[model samples]
Target: MTDRRLASVGTAAESRLPSRYLTPMDLVAMFRLPSVETVYQWRRKRTGPRAFRVGRHLRFDPVDVRAWVDAQRKEVAV
Candidate 1:
Protein backbone atom coordinates (compact mmCIF):
# COMPACT_ATOMS: atom_id res chain seq x y z
CA MET A 1 0.00 0.00 0.00
CA THR A 2 1.09 3.59 -0.56
CA ASP A 3 0.89 4.26 3.18
CA ARG A 4 3.27 1.45 3.93
CA ARG A 5 5.73 2.76 1.32
CA LEU A 6 5.55 6.25 2.84
CA ALA A 7 6.20 4.91 6.32
CA SER A 8 9.26 3.01 5.14
CA VAL A 9 10.56 6.08 3.36
CA GLY A 10 10.19 8.17 6.47
CA THR A 11 12.10 5.64 8.53
CA ALA A 12 14.89 5.57 5.96
CA ALA A 13 15.13 9.36 6.02
CA GLU A 14 15.34 9.39 9.78
CA SER A 15 18.14 6.84 9.70
CA ARG A 16 20.14 9.05 7.31
CA LEU A 17 19.85 12.14 9.50
CA PRO A 18 23.10 13.37 11.06
CA SER A 19 23.93 12.91 14.73
CA ARG A 20 23.34 15.84 17.07
CA TYR A 21 25.64 18.80 16.52
CA LEU A 22 27.57 20.24 19.47
CA THR A 23 28.36 23.87 20.15
CA PRO A 24 31.62 25.08 21.71
CA MET A 25 30.02 25.33 25.12
CA ASP A 26 28.68 21.82 24.80
CA LEU A 27 32.16 20.59 23.96
CA VAL A 28 33.52 22.45 27.00
CA ALA A 29 31.07 20.73 29.28
CA MET A 30 31.47 17.37 27.60
CA PHE A 31 35.24 17.47 27.92
CA ARG A 32 35.40 19.44 31.18
CA LEU A 33 37.81 21.88 29.58
CA PRO A 34 38.71 25.20 31.14
CA SER A 35 36.71 27.22 28.64
CA VAL A 36 35.42 27.49 25.11
CA GLU A 37 38.58 29.38 24.25
CA THR A 38 40.46 26.10 24.59
CA VAL A 39 38.37 24.68 21.79
CA TYR A 40 39.26 27.60 19.55
CA GLN A 41 42.92 27.16 20.39
CA TRP A 42 42.73 23.48 19.47
CA ARG A 43 41.10 24.46 16.20
CA ARG A 44 43.90 26.87 15.43
CA LYS A 45 46.53 24.25 16.22
CA ARG A 46 44.69 21.61 14.14
CA THR A 47 44.98 19.25 17.09
CA GLY A 48 41.31 18.87 17.89
CA PRO A 49 38.64 16.81 16.25
CA ARG A 50 37.50 18.34 13.00
CA ALA A 51 34.72 20.95 13.09
CA PHE A 52 32.47 22.58 10.54
CA ARG A 53 31.06 26.07 10.34
CA VAL A 54 27.32 26.49 10.22
CA GLY A 55 26.51 30.01 9.08
CA ARG A 56 28.66 32.11 11.48
CA HIS A 57 28.99 29.55 14.27
CA LEU A 58 31.22 26.50 14.70
CA ARG A 59 29.72 23.04 15.07
CA PHE A 60 31.07 19.60 15.87
CA ASP A 61 29.60 16.28 14.89
CA PRO A 62 28.98 14.03 17.90
CA VAL A 63 30.25 10.97 16.05
CA ASP A 64 33.54 12.61 15.18
CA VAL A 65 33.97 13.94 18.70
CA ARG A 66 33.41 10.50 20.19
CA ALA A 67 35.87 8.94 17.78
CA TRP A 68 38.46 11.55 18.72
CA VAL A 69 37.94 10.81 22.39
CA ASP A 70 38.33 7.13 21.79
CA ALA A 71 41.55 7.73 19.91
CA GLN A 72 42.98 9.57 22.90
CA ARG A 73 42.50 6.66 25.25
CA LYS A 74 45.56 4.95 26.70
CA GLU A 75 45.55 1.55 28.29
CA VAL A 76 47.07 1.14 31.72
CA ALA A 77 48.17 -2.20 33.18
CA VAL A 78 47.56 -2.83 36.84
Candidate 2:
Protein backbone atom coordinates (compact mmCIF):
# COMPACT_ATOMS: atom_id res chain seq x y z
CA MET A 1 0.00 0.00 0.00
CA THR A 2 1.10 3.60 -0.51
CA ASP A 3 1.21 4.24 3.22
CA ARG A 4 3.57 1.31 3.76
CA ARG A 5 5.82 2.47 0.94
CA LEU A 6 5.89 6.01 2.32
CA ALA A 7 6.71 4.77 5.80
CA SER A 8 9.56 2.63 4.44
CA VAL A 9 10.97 5.57 2.51
CA GLY A 10 10.77 7.78 5.61
CA THR A 11 12.53 5.19 7.69
CA ALA A 12 15.30 4.82 5.13
CA ALA A 13 15.79 8.55 4.92
CA GLU A 14 15.89 8.90 8.70
CA SER A 15 18.57 6.25 8.86
CA ARG A 16 20.62 8.11 6.26
CA LEU A 17 20.14 11.67 7.49
CA PRO A 18 20.10 13.45 10.82
CA SER A 19 16.68 13.84 12.41
CA ARG A 20 16.97 17.62 12.34
CA TYR A 21 17.61 17.99 8.65
CA LEU A 22 15.23 18.22 5.68
CA THR A 23 15.75 17.93 1.94
CA PRO A 24 15.15 20.82 -0.45
CA MET A 25 12.03 19.10 -1.75
CA ASP A 26 10.75 18.95 1.82
CA LEU A 27 11.29 22.68 2.11
CA VAL A 28 9.41 23.29 -1.13
CA ALA A 29 6.43 21.40 0.20
CA MET A 30 6.65 22.75 3.74
CA PHE A 31 6.74 26.36 2.64
CA ARG A 32 4.46 25.91 -0.36
CA LEU A 33 7.25 27.29 -2.51
CA PRO A 34 7.11 27.28 -6.28
CA SER A 35 9.71 24.66 -7.06
CA VAL A 36 12.97 23.00 -6.09
CA GLU A 37 14.69 25.42 -8.45
CA THR A 38 13.33 28.27 -6.33
CA VAL A 39 14.95 26.72 -3.28
CA TYR A 40 18.24 26.58 -5.15
CA GLN A 41 17.89 30.17 -6.23
CA TRP A 42 17.24 31.28 -2.66
CA ARG A 43 20.27 29.36 -1.50
CA ARG A 44 22.44 30.98 -4.13
CA LYS A 45 21.19 34.43 -3.19
CA ARG A 46 21.43 33.69 0.56
CA THR A 47 17.91 35.05 0.84
CA GLY A 48 16.17 32.05 2.36
CA PRO A 49 16.49 29.97 5.49
CA ARG A 50 20.06 28.80 6.01
CA ALA A 51 21.03 25.47 4.50
CA PHE A 52 24.09 23.30 4.46
CA ARG A 53 25.66 20.58 2.33
CA VAL A 54 25.39 16.99 3.40
CA GLY A 55 27.41 14.76 1.09
CA ARG A 56 26.46 16.85 -1.97
CA HIS A 57 22.84 17.17 -0.87
CA LEU A 58 21.27 20.23 0.69
CA ARG A 59 19.74 20.01 4.15
CA PHE A 60 17.79 22.48 6.29
CA ASP A 61 17.22 22.66 10.00
CA PRO A 62 13.58 22.98 11.05
CA VAL A 63 14.55 25.47 13.74
CA ASP A 64 16.14 27.75 11.20
CA VAL A 65 13.17 27.44 8.86
CA ARG A 66 10.78 28.28 11.67
CA ALA A 67 12.81 31.31 12.63
CA TRP A 68 12.90 32.52 9.05
CA VAL A 69 9.17 32.19 8.74
CA ASP A 70 8.64 34.09 11.98
CA ALA A 71 10.95 36.85 10.84
CA GLN A 72 8.98 37.19 7.63
CA ARG A 73 5.69 37.84 9.37
CA LYS A 74 4.12 41.28 8.92
CA GLU A 75 2.03 43.06 11.52
CA VAL A 76 -0.96 45.28 10.82
CA ALA A 77 -2.21 48.22 12.91
CA VAL A 78 -5.91 47.78 13.63
TM-score of each: 0.68, 0.67
After superposition, the stretches of candidate 2 with alpha carbons farther than 4 Å from their true spots are 1-19, 74-78
Worst 10 residues of 1 by lDDT: 69-78
What RMSD value applies to candidate 2? 9.5
**lDDT computed for candidate 1:** 0.82
- Winning model by TM-score: 1
- Quote the positional error of residue 74 for candidate 2 in Å: 4.9
For each candidate, what is the lDDT? 0.82, 0.81
In TM-score terms, candidate 1 sits at 0.68
In angstroms, the error of model 1 at 14 is 17
How high is the lDDT of residue 7 in model 1? 100
As for candidate 1, its clashing pairs are none
Error of 2 at 36 (Å): 0.2
